[model samples]
Target: MSVKIEKAYILKSFVINESDRVISVLNEKGEKISLVAKGGNRLKSRFQGKLEPFSFVKVEYFDRGKGGLNSLNNVELLENLQKWIKGDMKKFFALSFLNEVTDRFVYEKERNSKIFRLIKHVIDSLKDGVDLKLAISYFSIWMLKLSGVLSEFNEEIQCLNEILAKPLDKLDCKEPQTIFNFGLDLISKNSDKPLSSADMLKNLI
Candidate 1:
């Protein structure tokens, strides 16, 4: 009966029936939530062009509170990531991969603000023309640490720490592959299996 407002990033969305859409999003605190956007697919719908995946928006919804799907009432766009999505296919894939893996790792209603900020940072770097490999690699390493699966990297601890502390524009990492592989190993050791995106990324490099 009560409505809640949340800032979220659209991760995945698809049409259901003819006029509605089912959307999955990561809230500001890195919690996953599902919403049913009534009539979202119709022309002139309030949610049109605003719920595109990877975009950031403020959403208002009514929680059913019994494990039922939330009723999405309104969406307000906060950021549009279309520049990155349309600029390079490779970068798009990498971002998509990151989004998918994030959805997989972050549990529903679980808050992890650090991870949310990290994701935004990586996406910002990609949009700023930072090397895709480097950005993706950076994302993977942080993800590893967030998941508590990263192995010790004594030699690169300083660089890793610097990366963790500094903004993307300030970073200067020459060999992102090393960090990337370290992260891959961590994921392999922790998850049910390596993320499918790993293989697709390998082909790109």
Candidate 2:
């Protein structure tokens, strides 16, 4: 099958053999594709720079079997997220956690415009230097809302609007984990959608 590589970002890649690696990518079409790359891990490999996680790229592929996983025929590097790749621990962890959540929940070959836009907003926000915690919380709230896993920002929760509007340093997410959990409870009480792991996260918190 031949299709335009709409919005591709390298999410994660790992070595499989001496010269090959398995790469996971997120596309604008909201696909999670697993493809094998030859010599992707070599220091000077053709895919060295292109396959780095978080680097946005435009790509083309070929598939001979099922509908989702395809072979990467070519790729065009678009944005190198290297600078933002390594930085403050909190920001990095927040980013990684969101990406992992996305990777797990999004279906292969399934198209979700909202998720796509959310991710685009996320990457751009991260790249552009938005307050890291604010950015993460924003995306988290948006992600839950987008997935129908959570709902609108209700005002009933204590100072929810104020929290959203305040500076990260000024806000005491005293226990982000706990706050997030409590926030969800307040949301779920007001929401109609079925809560999943996001709902479960409240327990973990």
Candidate 3:
């Protein structure tokens, strides 16, 4: 098996057994891939603090070829946004919604650098303290646009023209609630099942 190292953002993880964990990540190339981390759940495992959700990491793994999970060898932490929003419930749920939407829309092993950059941009903007509602709206619209479900002339999203034009950090929305609801409606319609974080986010709004 050939070993490969790549930069990735952890989307989610699942504990498979007492010591093993399955991690899903969106790599820098914009491909969603899952890796199995041996002893990942153990206290002293090398992966102990490196595999949390929403973390940016450099992962070394053995590529076992297509149609199978890769085996994780080592992982190095690059950035962890979890700490920044530790005591903020709204920010936490917003990040969770973003993660879930990305996990749902991105296809495994299919490269789309636009989506990858978009994710990086939004996360970076969040770190820099951009308006939360505007950031969420920006991500939702961009995801729809990138997935071919939205168009510039789409009547429903016309009110967001200014929002789409500005950078996330420079964005100003006079009616953020309107834009947010529109984006959320589109996301709800596109998703197969109900989004787990949607209600939690809305209740907090």
Candidate 4:
């Protein structure tokens, strides 16, 4: 019953037996981790608001080896990204799509700091009023590139890679559909698993 503490971003959550919930998160190592929050739905639960998706938190959980689901013990809120998501359906959908994509493509216990940094940058950009479609497209391309699924030899791909090299805050992502489409095509061909939020994102745009 040794406990471990780490900083992480809540990615997704689901209720299981009415009172308990399973939370999915990306830890500081950029690895997917899950924790069970007992009685997390109770009105007085310590996990209230702390386990919500998109909130960055420092969490303590029981480390039950690799195969068992860990139990959450405590959480400290770091950032409330949900505050920026409210009433912004487009931005919410875009982030949801990104989260789903990450959850689908990234395997548990694997580390990829580049993709993690890119995700953090895109989230901050969205909060700062950057274009939603542009952020999504830019993120999609870079995520694909970092995952090693996109070809770097192609002229267009090379140009797109150069664009990502710029600091995210300074890069212009205007009309990024071409790169977006290329990334999506690569994702489609490489993975058989479907992104659950993909259709919703398309309809929103």
TM-score of each: 0.86, 0.71, 0.94, 0.89
Best by TM-score: 3
Q: Per-residue lDDT tens digits of candidate 3, residues 89-147?
A: 99889889988999999988888988878989998998888877778888988888888
Per residue, candidate 2 scores C-alpha lDDT tens digits across 41-149 of: 6788877678777667887767544854577767888887667666755555555655666676576666677676677776676677665545555556655655675
Ten contiguous residues minimizing lDDT sum, candidate 2:
196-205
Between the candidate structures 2 and 4, which one is better when assessed by TM-score? 4
Model 4 lDDT tens row, 56-130: 889999988765899999989999877887777777778787788888778888898777777888888877877
- The residue pairs found clashing in candidate 4 are none
Which ten residues in a row are the worst by lDDT in model 3?
150-159
Q: Which number leads on lDDT?
A: 3
lDDT of candidate 3 vs native?
0.86
Error of 3 at 8 (Å): 0.7
Q: Which portions of model 3 miss their true places by more than 4 Å?
A: 151-159
Please, what is the whole-model Cα lDDT of each candidate in the order they appear?
Answer: 0.79, 0.63, 0.86, 0.77
Alpha-carbon deviation at 3 in model 3, angstroms:
1.5
lDDT of 1 by residue, 1-205 (tens): 6799989889989998889998998888788888999999999898989888889999999987767889999999999887657776687678777887787778777789888898888888877888777777677777777877545644544457766677777888766777666655555456665677666777775
| lDDT, model 1, position 21 | 93
Ranking 1 against 3 by lDDT, winner: 3
